[model samples]
Target: MKKKPKLLKKNEGLNPAAAAPKIEPIVVPINKALAIRVVLMAGLVVLKT
Candidate 1:
């Protein structure tokens, strides 16, 4: 038999550091690279629909 994972209640802090929400930083490429990627993705979506 497998043990169930422990569930933590909202606003319930067992450990201050652990209880805090961890945020990951977004990675953005240079403007020129980003523009090309966006244009390619848009073209793909248009073709798919």
Candidate 2:
């Protein structure tokens, strides 16, 4: 028995792994940044009231 997809080479391009994987930098300062974000959001909300 013959499977359908095997008949086409076009399907290989659709596989995510076949494309270049996105490499993101690991930001080590995320905790400090998150703290700053929370403080800023809190200040904004408090001042808006």
Highest lDDT scorer:
2
Regions of candidate 2 where Cα sits further than 4 Å from its true position = 1-28
The residue-by-residue lDDT of candidate 1 on 1-49, one tens digit each, is 2333343543335665655443212223456678999999999999999
Q: What root-mean-square deviation over C-alphas does model 1 reach?
A: 8.3
The residue pairs found clashing in candidate 1 are none
What is the clash count for each candidate, in the order shown? 0, 0
TM-score of each: 0.40, 0.43
What are the lDDT scores of the predictions, listed in order? Answer: 0.60, 0.63
Number of the top-ranking candidate, with TM-score as the measure = 2
Q: Write the per-residue lDDT of candidate 2 for residues 9-32, one digit (tens) a residue.
A: 356556646432421233446667
Candidate 2 accuracy as TM-score: 0.43
Residue 37 of candidate 1: its Cα lDDT? 92
